[model samples]
Target: MSDEDSRPVHIRRRGLDPADELLAAGPLTRVATGSGADAGSQWMATTHAVVRQVMGDHRRFSTRRRWDRRDEVGGEGVFRPRELVGNLMDYDPPEHTRLRQKLTPGFTLRKMRRLQPRIEQIVAERLDAMARAGSPADLVEFVADEVPGAVLCELVGVPRDDRAMFMQLCHGHLDASRSQRRRAAAGEAFSRYLLAMIARERKDPGEGLIGAVVAEYGDEATDEELRGFCVQVMLAGDDNISGMIGLGVLALLRHPEQIAAFRGDERTAQRAVDELIRYLTVTYAPTPRIAMEDVTIGDQVIRKGESVLCSLPAANRDPALVPDPDRLDVTREPVPHVAFGHGVHHCLGAALARLELCTVYTALWQRFPTLRLAEPAQENRFRLTTPAYGLTSLPVAW
Candidate 1:
């Protein structure tokens, strides 16, 4: 291994702060991503503007493939597990547009607003569980971890009995420490479950997202597409919200006033949710974008086929993006942060995430006005290895 790869580099974060290297990466810098399919040198977009530019222009920087080749749409020629389908992030326009258009109706602001009562109920139930678990409860286990999965099950129309199984599969698939074979096995199992659910939904549609898609689009939305949708939703809905809820609570715990700000009023709560998403960009980086052609971003010329990883945390924390970027301020006027990402492949569940967060943050504090950490913040384990950054176990007291 080369010296750069040999050197320890934390690309994600040190607690809530972006890794020193990422923040100091200036506009664009070449960085080695140790090992993976994405191993080797790539351009890192640190500033908000550059990241936005890279993400916004899909033609110049392709999300689908590094080279211009006409293979089958969803990983046909590519050597990946067959179960990985319908994820919009893995495709470019036309294919991406078609799938996104089909899924967009289900995640509209109106749909999310309609789902608010249920979201509130989920939060209340989670908080009650935490309360029953009593003081010094592990918030991650009792509240943060459970709520998102439960809510996702509800959204996706997985049976109550199957929710636990579904969550288990999700955890198994997403746990980064797991071997690739193990993770892929979990993914295959998850895929099998989704495929079965899709088949059932097709036969007898229910009120959930899968059923709604089945009923509306019918054959136009293939089983592969539906499976992909569910997978993406599960991936997006579970970890991102779970992490935000866990870490947002931790952040708010430190800033007592921010917790109050979340409980203040609708407008303040909305602003607080947006601000928190910006501050704790738990989805550390978006899927790395491959340059379709030689593109000059800042002073650097990214050659064709080169990959660019935009640091969401660093970009969000840039002084150019917001004043006093490091400090968590819920009261600040909302800025366009790439927390959910920018442009075409931006998070499909952004509305649902925001709704869940707004509901949870407001209700959690209201339910337990005296909520505080059971142990020192330093003792809490941060989930650094996972795709989403969060607390592994947050012991809390009311």
Candidate 2:
């Protein structure tokens, strides 16, 4: 029931249970977004209903308007050459259609289920390593970053040994603290690194997603397009997956009873994963949208060319979405939440992410029944600078 009513949407205390100031000022109000003098205000879709309205109605609120189309080819905006922009977040309709069609098969239910066994093995391996390393292990380093990071690497055909480089690149690019030039360089470097793997996959479809895409499409898609697509999907699950794993463990340990419910059964743990995603809302703010034309959402009219932001945590935590909204109950029945977003722009890696979470929570806790925070929960650093919200390092002792 308590939401920040007066304070700005972007600023919040940086730790576990950070104070949410956006709700205090009231939901669905305009607030200045950045710290700079040139910072302009935009309407924040804070409630579950409104956020879905904007994301769902892609026609009215186009994500492409934020960038100029003049730099790219055709009407596809920056997505024309396709190497310039990340997947569907850039293009609309036919352009989005073209790219989404090619990538869809790689994320199919069959693919996820197939990946499940490998994911469990990865989880078990990391857990075994942690056990060998003894208690008081840095879960973020040993288990969290390692588990999903490796899965994503394998999925994209990146070598598991090279994870450190990509992890730095992924985290640095999403970081808001870094200069724009610095972030752009990191992103470009990430794409370039994937180019090598894509080239390799071209000659031999190596069972990874990049190889899978080449297998189906053949020469229909250019290397550049495939490279950009690979880069986007590779990083898609990078921070969010690892963040959820680390944060999920932290949340479960805090509520030990909930931990017991998720420790073994995959079916129950799968449902609990959705609840955890809703409760955490770790990706605090994703890309903002701009109105292609004047759009009326709820009682407010968002004018043409205006940017719209969605506060994921606020919307997911909205009382209207569920009773006792702020309480983190793993037993809550699944409701429509915008944690992975809604409609056309909904997360492509969502199914894969859920499978990863289910495996992590179940296999991880089963391995360490005595898992507890190495330091006080308040002492752990909250990684607020990046696009996603997660712990910088989670120190846990079993």
Candidate lDDT (C-alpha), each: 0.83, 0.76
lDDT of 2 by residue, 31-123 (tens): 786667877789877888888888888777766643354633224334244445545677677677777778777888988888888888989
lDDT of 1 by residue, 1-398 (tens): 64323443424567777777777877888777667886778788889999999999998887764233644323346533345468777778877898888877677777777778888888888888888878879989988888999888888889988888888999899888899999999988999999999999999998788887778888888998889878888887788888998899999998887787866889899899999999989887777888777889766899877888888888899999999999999889999999999999888888888888888888888888899988997887887566678889889887
Candidate 1 regions with alpha-carbon error over 4 angstroms:
1-10, 35-39, 66-81
**Span of 10 residues, lowest total lDDT, candidate 1:** 66-75
TM-score of every model versus the real structure: 0.92, 0.89
After TM-score superposition, the amount by which residue 277's alpha carbon in candidate 2 deviates from its true location, in angstroms, is 0.4
TM-score of 2: 0.89
Report the Cα lDDT for candidate 1. Answer: 0.83
- Among residues 3 or more apart in sequence or in different chains, the pairs in candidate 1 whose N, CA or C atoms overlap within 3 Å are none
